[model samples]
Structure formats: C-alpha cells, structure tokens
Target: MSYMDFPSFSLVGSFYTDPSTMDNDPSHYDESCTNPSPWQDPGGSHFFSFQDILASKPNRAFTPPVVTCAFDQNGNPSLTDPLIGAPVNSTDTPGATNGQTPPFSPAKMVDLDVYQQGVSNIYGFVLKLTVGGTVLTGAMDPCTLNSIRFDRVLPTRGWAGWDSYGWGSFGGDSNACGVYQSVVRIPADTWPAASGSPILDQLRAATTQDTSGNLLLSIRMTLDGYQNVPWHASDFRIGRVLATVGPQLATDPSHCLAGRWLAGRSAGPGDAWDQPSLYGAPFEVKNNTVAIDLSNALMTSAPGQGPLNLGNLSVYIGDGSTGVVGTPFQTNDILYSLSGGIVRLPLTAEQAAAAASAPFFLASSLPGINGLSTFNKQPVLWQESATGFWIACDDRNFQLASDQPNPGSQPGFFYVTQWGQPVTDASQIEHHVFPCFPNNSAATVPWSGGYKGNSLSSDGCLEAVLCPGTHSGQFCLELSAIWDPGSRTPELESQLYFICLWQKGTPPPPPNLESGCPPQEQMMSAVVWSSYQINTKPDWAEIQRLMKVYVKLFPSMHARMDLSDQQTFQIFSTNPPWFVSYANMPGPATYTLPSGGVIASGTIPYYMTRTIDDPRLMPIMRDLSPNRLLTVLYYCYNLQQETQPTPPPPGEGAPHPTATPTRKGANA
Candidate 1:
C-alpha cells in the first residue's frame, strides 16, 4: 500500500455534533440494544452504526443523529448557554441535552489523560494536552488504547463524513473531565504517513483557536460536556510521534524489555504475545527526536549478521530513491554515525520525512555471536514508514524447517521462538494463550533466502487460536550449518539450528535403508565419522558401513538440512567427500607452516584420492592426522558452550530436561 493511504485525521478545528442532543432515529438502533429506536432508515442515512449507538456505556446515555442545530437565518450556529438537563430542540435552548446530562462537565477541570502503558504497533494518538502545563506537556502513551472500534457515519457526506470511523476504550481511573487520547490502529501500510511523518507541525497549525489561544466554539463545548465527540478528533494536537521498528514488543523483562511498546506485524506465525519470535524484540522510533538510541531495540542485526551485540552496529537512512545500480542507497543526512549505540537522524522537517518514508537499516562489520564473518554487503530491507517497519524471516539454508516443503512454496517465512535445541517434551513447549498468527501470511520478506514465492493470501492471515504443539515422544531435527564466510577456523563455531526444525508433530521417518553393512559395522563407521574420520575416501567396506550408519541419522537430518537437489549423502563418491571439518584436508585454503613459510593455496580437491596425486599436497601431509580431524569440531563445540546465551531465570516450574538418543547423519 502507498504510504499516503495511512489512517490519520487532519484538524479543521471544529466542535463535534452533540450526541445527547441528536434527534431519535429508530432505524439506527441495534436490535440488541436495551431500547431500540422506532423508525427505520431505508437508505442507511443514519450516522452511527446501530450496534455502536446501542452499546453506550452504562454510565452514559445513548442518542441518535438528527439535525438538532441548523444555521440561523443569519447563517450562525444556533447557540445556547450551558444548562443542566437542557432539552434538545427546546425553543428556549435548542440543541441542548434532551433532559439527559452529557458525560462531561465544564465546571470540572479537563486535563489530558496520559496512560503509561508500553508501546505497540497499533495506530494511536499522542496529543500535546497543554503546551507548557506540567501534566500536559509530556508525551501521552499510545499503547494505552487496547483496541479500535470501527463504525460508519455520514455527516454531510463530505470531509466531516470521514470523522468517526473507529472507536476504542481504555479501562482505568478516569474522572468526568479527563480527556483520553485513544489510538485507532490500522495496519501500518494502510495508515497515513502523517502518523509518523513530519506533518505534526502542519496538523498543530491546522487547529483553530480563539483570540485568547483557547480552542474554538465546537471543541470548547465538547470539552465542556456539551457534546460527546466520537471518532478521530481533528483538532487534537498530536504529541511527539513514535513508532516501532520490528513486529512486536517484548513484554517479559527477563528476555528483552517490558512496558516499552513497539508497533509492527500483528499477523504471522511468529507473533505470539509471550514468546517473541527470533526476528528479535520490537523497539520504538520517534519523530523530531533528532537522535535515536538503538542499543535496546532490534535494529542492530540484519540477516546473516547473527545476534546483535554492543558497539558493533552501523546505521543508515535511505535516500528516498528507487534502489538501482550506480545510485547511492543511503542518505548523507545522517549527521552522526552510531556512537554509544545511538544514531542521530536529520532534524529538519523535509529531511526527516524523506528519511522516514524511505528505507532505514542497520549494518555491523563485526562477527556475530555465531562466529560467522562475511564481506558481502547487508542490504536494507526496512522502511521507517509512518507507523512501523516490517520484518521477514531469513531462514538461511534451513528452509524445510519452515511450514513450506521448500522455500517459495508459500508466503511468509517462519520465525522460531526457540532454535538450536528442541523443546524436548510436549509440556515444555510454551503455548500461545491468546492468539497465533496463521502460517505463510506475512507482509514482506526484508531479506532474501531461498524463499521466493510472494502470495499474500488474505485468507490465512492472522488467526487467533491455540497454536499447534508437539505431542510427547515425538522426535524433531535440530540441524546446524556453517554459513558462507570469508574464512572458517577451528576457533569459530558452527551455527546450530540454522533452520529451526518443524517441532509440532512426529518427525518424518528416515529413507528406506539400502542393502549395506551389518549393524555392528555400521556402529563402528558412525563412531569413526563422529570422533575421528577425516575428509578422505574410505574403503569400500567402510563406505557401506557409513551408509548403514546414516540410516539411523538421515531421517531427522533430511527435513532440516538445506542441500542441493540430491537428497542422499555421497559416501560412496570418490570426489571430495563430506566430513565434520575439512580443516585437515588440502584445498583452496592457504596454510602457514610451522617454519613460518606459507604454503601456496592448492588447486586440487581436498579428498584423499583427489589430493594424493597433487605435488602441492606434499607439505600439508605432515600436518594431516586422525587427531587433527577432530580438533575443529572439538573447538567449535567449546566455543558454542562458552557463547551460549544465558537462560532466563526459572519461572513457575522446573526447567525441562534435554532428551537423549539424538538423531545423526545426512538421513537415516
């Protein structure tokens, strides 16, 4: 959707038509209402939705829309002094409440009611209640409004007709004169760019005020309890506009943060409220704030960069140009680079608008927590639009772990809340108690992996139900891989669960075992491969033994491994064969000898048969040993143990125990 389509209201600075004073229209009354109206509206001319009109709070009285106030012969609005229990259409006080008191009271002091709840992606208002007052000058929390209410109303069928489409409620301490600034959140793409753009000054200027700086007649009456305003209040001054950068806010303090709301995707498999998906924790970005601190937000790490860490991020703002070759992707308006983990954005109105309406991204040159380092450019995938940015899961080489049979089979990429390990038992998997986003329905994929299909199916979008869970005793795969890096060393660790496994049901069984070695021989080959095998051609008997061993491990691995079209291992092949690590093998890699002289890189393949004939391999043979084959894997496991993220403190129960008899090999 175009950024201009965002949902927002511009102030004309007018007062709302009083609901209590409106004439009765029975056709607009909902049948479920305690008291239905008597008249029918054949043309649907009634302003408010029947249900909304009928569902007035018990503390408030319901009224219908009618021409209670019309232009006088002189074209002035008919006026009346404030009077308690005044009647509508009263000859003496026309358009007054029809013997029913309005919910507001002018005598009571009216102040902006600020809710301090956490932020969210839902569209909301942040009005500057009072310019300089102690209570009014602060920012109103947009996260307070729980939900939006939409109703159809036609007021003159013009600009005013756009006024009261959505309604929302906040349950908390509120006085008769307290004014709430509720947000009617729509999807970020549908919301008006003004919601987060530099249109605040223009909107604030649009509001009409009296000579003494007080609001005009209509707003004064509404705030004074003469009328109850429904829908977007055009005259309200929006507070410093803020939006989220990711799909959701983390509510648990132990994991990321709580009470700091971010607005992003409300639909998708990863949008579980309690267990935030691995797209990372959502964070806030506000307009006109000059500098933004992203150390606490999820903006640091991009796809392939691995998990974020302090002092490693570089921030960039898109220049509002279609990305093309030879064109600069980033804007020079970034006055300050990331320092102390904060990025200073352009402060001017025009620059800020261009920056927000275009793409915004973060890049880091440092190696990620996974220990993989790359020299390729990390592309920008997010646009800091009016409300929030979008995030797409990059499954790397592990597409089968997603709901799709392969990449591109469906829409959205799956986001794993837990990775690298299995949940172990059914009871250990945390269930989404309130809602579950439907699989394959996502906005966009920020970065490309193997996922190529883009079918935004409206049908299976956001589903609110109990998510699927695994039954006890079911086996799941946890595949790990080494990404394409500039270099791979024994000091670096391999990424575990590079593709999160499908953990919701019984794992698919291994392929049928081919004619091969006996069980005892198979066990020996498996032990050799895991503990001592080097990258070399094995004997014919050993090849059969390895095949037999793979039979035990391939089932779990087949669904989790991202390989070429070939589904089976190449154990019998004479070409470069697979091993835990090729470090001890000779290949394109250059090596420095113990004498401090470097061995020029080899052009020959690394397998025992392939490299034995290459004269350049003579020097490296001195370093080759059965023990060297295990060193790389041993160090990788050690680094993984040292770098594991600290487990969150125990909750209400004992931590789940890990299961045994883990799967092995390419396929079993």
Candidate 2:
C-alpha cells in the first residue's frame, strides 16, 4: 500500500509529491490512521511547506559606527566638541611649569570608509503540519497550518504579453545596483489560493562581497499573515554580483583670469594698494597683508557641477615659495558670492568664526617676524590643479609665517609684482605692510611715551624720523631694505635718504589755555643709521666717523653717539627739539644794560623768520593749473627763549654765544 496511487501520480498529484514533501511530512501514509488516506499523516493531519532559493537593499547600511571619547572641559559626554576652537597645550601634563607650550597640536582623524555588508539570502525552507479540523497555537506557529498561496502577487512586475523572459533589472543608482523583478505564474499547484490577504506585502534586496571579493545579492519576501521569507531580487531575483565603475579628474585653465587684491593695515588715499592683484598683477602692500581681486575669476556657470560651494571648497595660496618645493599654504576661503565673482579669501588665520569683530592686528595677538604683534598674512599665487577628489590651487611662501618661526623673522613674502621694473626668475618682494612695503615702525610701534618727551638715553640705539603732518609733524621709524631685482638679500649697507619732519607746539603757561593752534614747524629730519651687522659687535670707528659728519653737525647728537650695539643704529631728531621749554613773547620791551653782570630780558618782535639755502621755494602769487610746487600751509609764531639760572654745559646742547649787540638791563 504505497502512499500515492497511479491515477493520483499523474499531473496535479506528481507536481505536489516530491522527496521534500516526504521529508517534511511526519507519519506520511501511516496505515493505523483513523481515516485511511495517503495524504494524511499518522495523526490524520496534513503539512504545508515553503522554500526560498534566494533574498536584498542595495544602498542599505548594515551598521553605524560607535565612537569613544575623553571627557571635555565641560565634562558632558553628550555635548560633542565641534573641534574648531583655539588650541590648548595638551602636553601640559601634571605639575607642568606655567606658560609651557606643546610642540604641536596634531589634527584629529576620522575613518570615512564603510564596510559594505555583502549579499547573503542563499536559500530557506518552511514546513508546518496540521489536522484538517484542528486549531493551531497562534499565527506565529506556522509548523501546524493549512496549505496557502498568495491572493495576487504585488510589487507587481507586469508581463502580460510575453511568456519567455519576464524578469527586469531596473532601479540601479550610483550607491548600489538595482533589483530583478519577475512575474511568472506559480506553476499550477495543488495548494489553494488564500484570497483577500496581502499576497505581495513587501520585497527587499541587499548586496555584499564574498571571501573572493565577488559581489552577492540577497532579498526577502513577505505577505500579510506570513510576513517574512528569504527571496533575493538580484539580477536573477537571487544572490548575484553587481557591476560598478570608478572615478576621474579635471585640469587647469590656460586663460582663466586677472585682478588686484586690496588688503592691509593701511589702505586709503595715497596709501598702499587697497586692491591687490590676483593673476600675478602688480599692486601695493598696505597693512602687512596683500589682497588679490578675483572678480575676474568670477563666473555665473561654475566649471564643475554647480555653483561653487565655498563651504565644500578649500582655498590655497600659491606664492613663489612652496610651489617650487611643494607644500603650499592652505588658507580659509572667506566667501564666494552666490551671484558674483567677488571671492574674498583671508590667509593663515584659523577659527575665523571665533575671532572678534575688530581689525586682524587689533583682534589677535600672534606676532610676525617683527617683535610687534601681527595676524597671519601670507601673500600667494592661486594655482589651478587637482589632487584626487579635491583641487590643489594655491602656492605660498612659508618663510613669512611658519608654525614656530624665529621671534622677529618675517614670513617669506615672495610675489611676482613689478615695481615698474622687469620681472625675473627670482623676482621677489618682501614687505611688512601689505602689497609689499617695509613698515614705518615708529607709527606702528609708538614709543612707550610720545616721541616728544622721550630721550636717546634709553638703553638701546633708536632710529627716528619726522614726516609732515596736518598740524606739526609725525615721528616715524624706518627699516632699510632695498628692492633688488638680481637677488633676495636684505638691504644692509649704508644709504642716503631724507624724511620730512614735525615739531611739537609751544606749551602754554599756568592754566594752560592754549587752543586753536595751526600746523607748525614743517621741516626735514636727516637720518643716518648703519645696518652693517658684519660681526657680533658694530664697527664704532667706521660708524661714528660717518654719523658725526652729518648727525653731530646737528644738536641731537650733542650727547655721545655710540653704534657699538648694532641694535641701536637709529639716529633720532625733531625740532624745535624735545625736552625744551618754549617761552612766551611779551611784546617789544626796552631794557638797560647792567654795570655789574646781569642777563637782560627783551621781547623779540613777531616776524616771519625765513631762511633759504636753495632758490627752489618760490611763492606763487596765484594757483597754477598743474602746480609743480606744493603750497605748504605756513603757521606764524614768535621764538622766545626762557633764561635758565644754570645753563646746560656747552658740550651738552648749549648754543655757542654770538657777539651781536643787544639791550641789557642795569642792576648795579
């Protein structure tokens, strides 16, 4: 008594009966059953079985990484640090001395790679046994249920006209490969259709690589009552590999642009250039910084995909310094207007968002090579190359502002700006004020007290000068660095130059009711300083000889002038001299000479005291159209000297007495 009868073994019965059915069905065709049937098990029950040969989300992430961190200053684990703040000396360990600084602060790194979980829905099978009239434990207990089929397949793949190849691979994107959905009528089976139920509830596929790195796809099937089954929707709707492509790059522009960069500490009328050049054009230096006008680099339709996103774009500065040696400076791109080509980029500084809303030099305390404080400013040439997925577009001179440079050494500021001269291979300009001009140090680093009441007696030699100003004059310090086209050497030799000078106004008597004073005493202060640093000490004999001929001729050097300390080569002069009391003229007064010795006091008449060594200063009666000469504003004042009970030694700034006759008072 074999279970399957000959008549039942034909079409439907043969399709229904397989070794899988026999293995999954317990007590199949048992003779001791209450109802003698070949389809019934030993307990007069039937069995239901489902098998899946495959299962996939092509773009799904299998896992998100977990992170570990140390306690921050705030001690809150959840409050993540943005990691873009001023650096702290992390090397400041326990009991470290004050003001201790670490060698460097290395940037933190992050893992950007993701391990793609390869596909895995190979095969799966489900089997359940049940009596025709018996109730099962629950819906989850599929081991004892009646035979069932989908009401109507969903995720509907349409194959109405064709009978041959019905599968379609249609949803591929950059991140992952698409699915192969097929619509084939389930082979006419003996199982009954479970109508009104979610026949095709959901379908998903995933992709991964095997030990050999061959990609495998996986998918799962789900219905209303029975919600999960392993069925891959690969190109075969089974676990299979995916085909992918790699990436490429872009190049530089031959004829891209040109413009000026206008930035620095001093950028106004008659000052250094306010707009510096971008396409290697020549501009002027202002406040130790250079600005290039990139208005020409402006474009409506960006070269690449879309409008330039400055947040995603990195800025580089290409000076003559690093491009020849690699390692260009990576500056922060300030802003690229969404609608215009006005791209403004600031160099060398960081944590820009945290900086206060003041000028860079005023807001920050970082110092350049000069002892005076300065913010980062490195002039550069903008290149146009790309590295991997990003663009490499800047070359910089690191000598200007390196990480831990010598205290007073200026950063290398090699640019290709022509000062009305020919450009060469080593065509360079190193300046403190931007575009490229050596700084006028006196105004930049004003003396502790004003220059008017100061002395040359301070420990070091001081170089000072006077420039014409609105009222009196301004004392300025000058650095001598020649602009040499042949080489990049410091201008260290002696040279002759002139500086316009100024003098303080007369100090009023008690109650100090001085007001409405006009511009006074416009003159030239001759400067003679030695920059010869040939040895550890200066050559006093050679220096003093040159200085004495010019400077000792003036009254400022009445005290000893020593250039032994190379640091103090500066020769200061201003008039009517510092540390002198100006006297008030009390009109014309008559006085009698004394038989006994007694110095008499007399009022010097008020009149313009003019001295002309050269005939070039001719006063024009009227304004000339293009005036070759400047009409200097003249202020009038009377010169009156106060009598000192005890005069300074004749060697110490006392004027040599003149034998001219004058009125003397009679006291004896």
Give the TM-score of each candidate.
Answer: 0.19, 0.14
How many pairs collide in each candidate, listed in order? 19, 66
**lDDT tens per residue, model 2, 493-574:** 1111212111122232111112211111111111112222112122334434323321212122223333233223322111
lDDT, model 2, position 105: 14
In terms of lDDT, model 1 sits at 0.21
Model 1 alpha-carbon drift over 4 Å, by segment: 1-128, 132-202, 206-309, 316-361, 365-368, 371-668
Candidate 1 clashes: the total is 19
Each model's C-alpha lDDT?
Answer: 0.21, 0.17
**Per-residue alpha-carbon lDDT of candidate 1 for residues 368-486, written as tens digits (9 for 90 to 100):** 22211222353222223332222112111111111111111211111222211112343332211111011211111111222212122211212212222232122222221111111
lDDT of 2 at 588: 17
